[model samples]
Structures are given as C-alpha cells and as structure tokens.
Target: MASRDDALRALEDRDWSGAEVDTSPSRPAMVVQSIRLPEDLARWVEDEAARQGTNPSVVIRGLVERAARPAGRTDVVTVRRTELELALHQAVERAIEPAA
Candidate 1:
C-alpha cells in the first residue's frame, strides 16, 4: 500500500509535519497469536466465513467476542468491514432477513 498509495506513503514516511498526536488508545492493542484447530473445526470456520462473505479471521473474531460476553447480555454485535461496508451489511442481512 505504501508503495502504490501516496497518502499511505506519506503516513508511512512518519514526517508528522506538526500534526497533533493522540497517544491514548480507545481499545485494547492488537495481539497476534497462532493456534492449531482440528480439521473438522477448521472446515466449519471456513464455511462460516464463506457464508458471511468475510474472511476466516473475522468469523473467528466474532465467535470469540460472543463467547467472551457475559450470559444474559442483550447487546447486539455487528461485524462489518470499512471497505465494501454496504456489501458486508447486505450479505449479513440476507442470512437472517427472511426469519427476522
């Protein structure tokens, strides 16, 4: 992206040029770890990701998020993409709209 995109390149160059910096982060910092899943579970995750029209990482994240929430919590969680935002919403809607 830095090689092909000027805006990204400018940011990558890190010549802040007097831009204000906000050191505070609103959410937990990202942590990367690798896990090994059994073949059957792996297939299920891949299938769910395909059904949701998202990558496996997103499906896994949503599952983890739901599991981490406390029981009886009524909060709704929506998984979305910054790029192709509308497309993602439509795909998700198609999965439940008929019953909903």
Candidate 2:
C-alpha cells in the first residue's frame, strides 16, 4: 500500500466496530474502506472515472473486482436456484409443447 495521509492512517489503525467480514456472495454487504493514495494516482483515478462517465467509486470497484477475478473465469454471478428452476421449466414446456 502507498503511504497514506496521517488522518487516513489513523482511521485504518482504529479497530473496526462493524461486521468484520461478509462471506455471502449474493447480496454481499457494502463496507466503507479508507486508504491513502498518492496525489497523482488519485487524480488519474478521478480522470479515468470522468472519461468513463462514472463516479470514482465505480471505477475503483471495477479495478478491484477485475483484479480479484482473473481472466478466463465465467462464474461471476448467477440467478438463485428457484429462479433457474422456474425458467428451465418454462423453456422445457415450450420446447416440448405439441402442435395440432
């Protein structure tokens, strides 16, 4: 991690009082994380976000998610089992429906 400003560093040093971890994938909780970044890099992130027509938070999240999931992986997210079953049933019924 790059050197954070003293205030940001202090925040990081403090113990978190909220939930420590979220293990669920679907409907995962959002947590605010503080980090210090070099001024130039932070500017670049803001610039990229502007170019992409999105806010800085979206850009940052995209970077983190892309890095966390390596290339050639398809299993990012999926529908719930119940939803899948319902869709599959409808498709099967349509495909096998008899014609007069």
Candidate 3:
C-alpha cells in the first residue's frame, strides 16, 4: 500500500480539477491548417453564423459535415424550383389562415 503523502503527490500531479483535455472535434485548437474563403462567401458565412447564433467557423464546419454525409441521409432535402415555390405558397397560405 502507498503512503498517504505519495497518494496526495500523485493527485497533485494529475490535476483533474475542472480542467478539460479538449478532445472535441469542434474545438478550434484541433485545427492545423488555415483556410481563406472568397470575400463574398466569407461575408455570407458570417451573416449566417449571426442568424444562427453561432461562430462562423462552426457554420462552415456544419456545412462541410453536411456535404460529406452520405446521400439521402440528411435532415434537409433538395427540391426542384417548382416544388420549392409550391411549398412556399402552401406555407404562406397556412400562415394567413386563421386558427380553428
């Protein structure tokens, strides 16, 4: 059995008091390369980040993840222009309709 002082010294060396090792993929410290986007796209990314209440990098990461995901497994669906217009019309009609 180890002495109490030795155990205390080991605990002091470990130092697990509220400090995280930060192994998460979303943490900025994990990135090794820097990327520069075109001005227009960068502005759009910032604007979208503001609208979504998150950092621009997070928005960009989400977009990259979405693009990399397997087809037909996404939460968002792509549609034809006519189908989008029809859906928009239906949504507007529903919004204008009075509650029952």
What's each prediction's clash count?
0, 0, 0
Give the TM-scores of the predictions, in the order they appear. Answer: 0.55, 0.46, 0.44
Query: How large an RMSD does model 2 have?
Result: 16.0
Candidates 1 and 3, the one with greater lDDT: 1
Per-residue CA lDDT of candidate 2, range 29-71, in tens?
Answer: 8998777889998999999877655678878887898899978
Deviation in Å, model 1, residue 44 alpha carbon? 1.3
Worst 10 residues of 3 by lDDT: 26-35
Which residue pairs clash within candidate 1?
Answer: none
TM-score of 3: 0.44
Model 3 segments more than 4 A misplaced: 1-29, 74-100
lDDT of 1 at 98: 82
lDDT of each: 0.80, 0.80, 0.79
Q: Candidate 3 lDDT, tens digit per residue, 1-100?
A: 9999999999899858888787768634656456798999999999987765568887888788788998888476566798568658767877898999
Provide the lDDT at 18 for model 1: 84
